[model samples]
Target: MERKIKIFMIDDDPDDREFFQIALDMTGIRYTLKTAESAVEALNIFPEFLELPDYIFLDLNMPLISGIQFLQIFRESADLNKVPIIIFSTSSYHKDIEDTKALGASHFLSKTSDIDRLSEVVVSILKGNDLPFILT
Candidate 1:
């Protein structure tokens, strides 16, 4: 049997987290989704992961330890650096996109309120058709 894709997402908003879960559930791809409300929480639980995530979706704005800061720390870690990190945020500012790309983010996906759109993007990433950057 094919192994389930392990996906980790860090976002402070509970509603946004729920939206992501719904999007993933809509996809045909088999996946296991784990989430942390903040970067600090994710870091605290990182060592306990039996299997590291195949992809990590991060939000730009949060109460503490913003996504960019987390990305810097994440890339500094030898073990975590290689994992694909996707900047999933509501911000569409050029600075945000460029900053994340420079920091080694695999892709920058805009957070859309449309569930169908979000699901489609999730499917693309899982299917390996992820473009350089995606805005939805």
Candidate 2:
């Protein structure tokens, strides 16, 4: 039996959070979404998690602690070794993609204003597919 997919997202933009949640809901997959506006806030609350999220959608930009910084810290946790980390960003830079992949990110997803496309991405990820943000 499939369990409810738990997703954790860290983004400072409220609109981004709301849009992503809507897209995720549209996938018709049972899920639970927990969001944090800042990496610092996310880190603080992370220890309280009773269960690990199926995936983590992380943004590259944020105040204080950038997403890249957070990724480094997050990867150090031996317990989270198997949890896939997906990079969520408006940036489609090749360097960003290469760097994150090297740092252990499973895939990169661009932040699109289109909800349908977002939903498609959500579905792809749930189906164990990748939507890589290639610079080309």
Candidate 3:
């Protein structure tokens, strides 16, 4: 049997999270989804997760602690820094993408209206494809 991919998503919007869950369910990808309303919540749970998630989808804009701040914190930590972190945000600004990539995000994906595109992006990330952002 193929191993199920473990995915952790740090998104503030409940609707977006639900949409992603529905999309994943429809795609039939063997994945485990975990949601965090804030980066603090994610950081709190990071240690307890049995293993590092195969993919981490993070939102750029959020209250309290932003995704960029989370990335900085994660980068400072040895244990969390090794895992693949993807900036899954609504922002499509060139500067935002560049800044995130420079800060060690594996990929910068804009929130898309198409579920098919989202699924494809997820699949590509899981398959270890050479994405357009930093893979560190």
Q: Using lDDT, give the best candidate's number.
A: 1
Arrange candidates by lDDT, highest first: which order? Answer: 1, 2, 3
Clashing pairs in 1: none
Range of the 10 consecutive residues with the lowest summed lDDT in candidate 1: 127-136
In candidate 3, the residue pairs with backbone N, CA or C atoms under 3 Å apart (3 or more residues apart, or in different chains) clash, namely none
Q: How high a TM-score does candidate 1 get?
A: 0.95
Best-to-worst order by TM-score is 1, 2, 3
Write model 3 residue lDDT over 66-113, tens digit each, in one string: 999999988898877788898989888788888888888989878877
Candidate 3 — which residues are off by over 4 angstroms? 134-136
TM-score of each: 0.95, 0.92, 0.91
**Candidate 1 Cα misplacement greater than 4 A, ranges:** none
- Clash counts per candidate, in order, are 0, 0, 0
| lDDT, model 1, position 51 | 79
Candidate lDDT values, in order: 0.90, 0.87, 0.85
What does candidate 2 score on TM?
A: 0.92
Q: Comparing candidate 2 with candidate 3, which one achieves the higher TM-score?
A: 2
Question: Model 1 lDDT vs. the true structure?
Answer: 0.90
